[model samples]
Target chain A: MQDARIRLFSFVSLSIATFLSVPGAVLSLGWLLLSPGTLRETMKSAAFWVILLFVTIIATATQMSGNDGLSYFIRTGVIILLGFSVYREWHPGEYLDLSVWLFGKKAGFDIGLAVEMSIQGLHEASREFARIRSALSLKGLQPGIRLIPAVGFLMIHTRLMRARDQADLLATRGYRAGGSCCPVFRTSNRDITMGILAILVVFLSFMPVRDIFILQM
Target chain B: MKLSLSAVEWNAGSWKFRADETFTPGVHLVSGRVGSGKTTLALLSARLLQPDAGAVEYEDIRSRTLSFQYPEYHITGSTLHEEAESYGVNPSAACARAGLAGRWDEDPFRLSRGELKLFQLSCLFMRQWDLLILDEPFSALDCRGKLAVCRSIGENRSGIVLVSTHEQHILPKTDYLWEMRTGKLTFRGPLPEAITAWESAPGPVRMLREQGVIPANLTRDDILEAVCRMHE
Candidate 1:
């Protein structure tokens, strides 16, 4: 996973497999769980459980039957796990390096810069959330429904200001929509093997494995 | 009351900060250039951020409030009335104090940035805090608003107040001074001593000192009085 290219390839392959086949998605979830500390970290987040519960409730409310609800829950859960696993492995900078390596420097740099900004935005959003929470605590107020609007407005305003500043900085630095970078990669043999395996898994997901197994029996 | 940092070390992104100093009761002005870890130190004093190494200890101080550089981040109410009343104060009085008296029913989000900052500052002043850490409180305020904030800090005689700002001019009467340089507490002592000791002291202070007009204190009024006396 050191090389962004192989890691991205594997992530794409797994995503395709998860979307195409239920069994393949389940298998991928199991594979992702093998990564050390993944399950522990995922479980520790209260937001993860709250989101999962919310999704389950919505699925149950909208589904035609019990089986449909169950299927929806499982599918969503697997996708979430897959996303978490991918995010855990990939650093934001790697996206830029990989893009520059794959495409011509100009187009690649633009895409990479976009990706970098998105990641930075997310980080700033989280930090802002913490600051808001602390502020509320200091004022002897708990974060309740009434506080949501204020929090949202503040977050948006700050984000807009930050975006404007970043734009100015980029302009001052003579950054165009496109720029060049020398892409370097440090992919190991294991990463290559994993990338190949991921592609094979995607291909296999398209086959009727249950039917094949039944026929052999 | 006293707030002390014992061999405190913290890292935020690429910046690393280390401090080992004690702060006594009164207005402590922490001045530094932008990105010199001033905000980091303020957060540390407020216990919003824990040091990677070392500790921050408070003596006879239980409650603390930290006002972020951006006042919008501290807003917790939907309307001006609600925000004004957030700190257990009379809504009408607080709104009047913040210069939003007639606009109480309006959403705080509808106000301009400077208005919102005034509202937040009004709420902050309403509460009794053992430690008050205001990071760049002067930003986004008009001259009148700035003067009001400085007066409020000067009047508050109960708690340990730490003001971290880049604005050397227009600060409240500071009892102690601390300077952050390159992620380190390069200077800490009485304000007058810091003014004399700080090699990169602000322009006005340096100019006065060069003219042999050392003020009795580091306040706008004190410095102005000294300069006027020198001219006379």
Candidate 2:
């Protein structure tokens, strides 16, 4: 969605609906399918597969323990899909614009700046991981189970160092919390449509399955 | 030992790179503008990346390595000692070689960028690789670090050393020249003769070529000698 506020609103509502019932998850899956390429793009990430594998293991364990694991699997998987779309659609300054538009200058700007920095940090960490892996391969070190701890340590250490550097830069620039910003948004009719649908889905999720079918008819 | 690219093609989204060249022993300086696929070429040459078509073949090249553009990317350890050991080099020896002696306990990230770069290069140069690909090795270095790198490149006598850089002034004596134009790797042939055909030649080299004098090599001394000869 072009409008960050609407996109976030839809995401939150859809996540809540998806978590409530199997029918809500089914509905959320339909919403996810509307994007078409989000699933494909999310699938391209190795991290996605790793997360899915972990979820699968937990779900399997739950099933073996006589719980409704299938429902849990569907809900979590759809939530992940929705989350990926939000991430993929995010522009650098969208959060700042939305926050400022919603909460005004001082408080919103500070919160928005923190969120922006955190998101950027995530991107930098991902890039760092790729470069570190390449470095390992160049050094004739193969990636296996044994190197996971070391790799994780390196990744976390670098991220913390980078965060510290960013903090220093902000301090040097005399930034003490709030900043001035003119918020702007370029929202489309489709964004509004999807947003309304998200709210409707939440309301429908709470209704009886028979009532939803009757209402549909 | 040799590294060869035969009709190799790699695609990254809309950008495409194609190369059909063979690199034999001695220093081959690959020069190109930024975003001209120099790093991609280095990675493909190092076999870190598989081409979408054709192949990159290594003939008798048992040991090989690729030095990344940013020195920070290669760091896997917290301290200088661990970093050296990560490269499988002795910590004290590598530290001393990089002029970081007695500072093995220092964090690798705490070192100045130039120091980190020198340290990384020093660790890599300690081993003899049949093929060594240095991608923008002089990027974060000072003049002294650049000279040290050039000196090390000069000392590698029996390997295919592919130095991909746009470094204009300081350079080791090179064997062949290649240029990456757009996304294609074009061979400019052996040096001296290749100097005339180097479309993206460095400023000094181009100036010397404009005066109808091609240096025997691309080193600082070679260009100065050529200039003196031009006056003579």
Candidate 3:
């Protein structure tokens, strides 16, 4: 969705619906597939698969005890896919706009700024990880379990130092709590259509299995 | 020892880089504008990046290391001592050489950007490598640090040292010169002659060249000598 407000709304609504039932997740997945490169990008992310594998392992353990772990896996997977889609469409200030519009200037701006910095930090961490891996290889060291502590330490230390610097920069630039900002949003008809579809998926999830089938028939 | 890039091509989205060159001994200064694929060349030469087309071949060359542009990216150590140790150099000596004496126990991240840069370069320069690709060695370093790095480059008379930077002044006496035009690596040949044809030659060098005086090398002393000769 072009509009941050509508996109966040649909994302939250879809997540709740997907968590409610299997049908909701299936519908949400189908809805997500409509977005251009969501499936391809999500599939390409090693992080996505790693989390999925971890979830799968847990779900398998649950399944061994004769529990309905398959449904849980499906719901979680769909939610992850939805999250990735949201991330793909994210611009720099979208969250700030959404938050400031939702909450008042002071609290919303603080929350939004925190979220923005966190996201920026994540981006930096990924780039730093690549450079660190390169540095390791240059030093004739392979990235293995033994090296995780050193690597993790470097990454965390770097991020913390950067955050400190950023705080200092903000202070030097005369920044204090509750700065003035006017949030603007642009929405397309397609955004509204998809948002409505998200709501419909939620309602569909609430229906009984037989009733859903009957309605479809 | 020789390092060669044979028809090497790397594609990043819409941007493309192609390099076909060979480096053999002495210091080779790679100059280019910002975003001119200098770092990409350094990475490729260091074998950190695999070319899309040809190959980066090394002959009778064993040890190789690439000093990244951002010195902070090289901090694999919590303390200055450990940071130097990570590079297999003596901690105290490296710290002292980088002018961070008695700060061995200090966190590497606590050092200013320039100090960290000088520290990283000092550690890297401590070891002899067959191929040492330094991308922007002078960046973040003050005049003294730059001169120290230039001196280090001057001292390393052996091996293929690819120093890619756009520092306007205070350069080491370079042996060979090369430039990155757009995405293509163009060899400017050996130093003295290369100075005339160097299109992206630094401002001082360009001015001297415009006045019909070509420096013996891209160094402050050489440029001064050339200007004196011009006056004569």
Candidate 4:
């Protein structure tokens, strides 16, 4: 579809997902409004409502709502839940982190926001480690595989996410319509790029980042 | 650094692949008839699909790489670069590799199928793997893109490159060949040995056998080139 439609659809769907996530949202929906889509689509998209119900429960059940940024907390919470719902419904079985709120606030940029959150997660991990390392030290844990993975998750999480998007964009460029690749490598610009890419590959191979920054989930 | 070790084991439906086939450290072409286990083989090697009763000896393969036939399957990020970064690839570089040289920050779910494939393909090739398994790597490639892929593999294709294809049109420079029938892996010696079989292959190979002037056995490319030459 058009870009506008796609963005609008995603935004509205995300917004509704956020609203529905509050504990009272579903109850409110039961007594309030319905989206324009068919009943099936609405039912399929119960994440927002679910989040609303959850928020209602948390607000009523606990005094946390009176803490701070209740609306902000709920908004960020809803967005995170909505993003998660989109991911769950889309791929069904893939594992990923809920990076929606890891980075404070994002205006509109998608990839940018994800990157920011990954870095934030890394920072948070560092803080968490410093805060809890002494406790673990007394427990006789030797800060081995666990320490590296805690930092690595954020890196792997962001990088692989970026790669997947690149794969999707190849489709828009009109590839594989009549099958892909030719037997012999045709000498062209991509070949030149292939050479440069070779150097980069060599660099990546020598790096020990795989052990340090890994995608655990 | 390496893929986890597991073997293929199964006794189900129309699919079958041998266990502990021992994928070597280079590109391998596993080809056979239509009913052969090409896609199933790729999945087995990549650890994306589990075998009936075998172990996948995946060694040292962290989550830096992603395995997906359909790009839609690998999408876990809310946006495009987010997806690439999830696989531990540079978002900008991944987008460029997928032919999305411009749309660096779009949602991965928003891109078309072809675009998604390119992005996934690049992300796949971006990292050095213990093994890179492709069922049909060239099923969705343009001439230039395919050539780029060929050259990329030629230069940087490290570890095991396990592939299965019937199309033969776009073939990798293979050192070994494995033929699967029913569920057994009919291990051929090398590409040359497989070429001998293809050259003298009974029903279909016979046609290209007569036309075989080139050394390569598979006629997908030669035949197409010949046909195009004849048309010209």
Where in model 1 is the C-alpha error above 4 Å?
A: A1-3, A16-49, A52-82, A85-114, A156-217, B6-17, B50-55, B182-187, B206-214, B225-232
Local accuracy of candidate 1 as per-residue lDDT tens digits, A77-143: 7777666666656576887887787777888889888887887797688788888888888777778
- Model 2 ranges with Cα > 4 A deviation: A1-5, A144-149, A171-174, A180-200, A214-217, B6-13, B52-54, B76-82, B90-92, B101-110
DockQ, candidate 4, comes to: 0.02
List TM-scores for all candidates, in order.
0.75, 0.86, 0.86, 0.45
Share of true Cα-Cα contacts across chains kept by each model = 1.00, 0.57, 0.61, 0.00
- lDDT tens string, model 3, B32-129? 99999999999999999889999999999988999999887777777999889889999999999999889999998788899999999999889998
Query: For residues B118-153, what per-residue lDDT tens digits would candidate 4 score against the true structure?
Result: 777787788776666665565566766666666566
Candidate 2 i-RMS = 2.2
Chain A TM-score for candidate 1 is 0.86
Query: All candidates' lDDT scores?
Result: 0.80, 0.89, 0.89, 0.52
TM-score: model 4 vs. ground truth:
0.45
Candidate 3 off by > 4 Å = A104-107, A180-197, A209-217, B1-24, B51-55, B77-81, B91-96, B100-111, B181-184, B197-199
Instruction: Report the lDDT tens digits of candidate 3 across residue range A1-217.
Output: 7898888889999999899999999999888888857578778778889989988998888888899889989999899888877886778987887788888799998888888888878878988898889998887778899888888888888888889999999999888986667999998999999999989988888987898675553
Over the stretch B80-157, how does candidate 1's per-residue lDDT look in tens digits? 777777777778877898888788888877888888888888878887778988999988888888888888998765
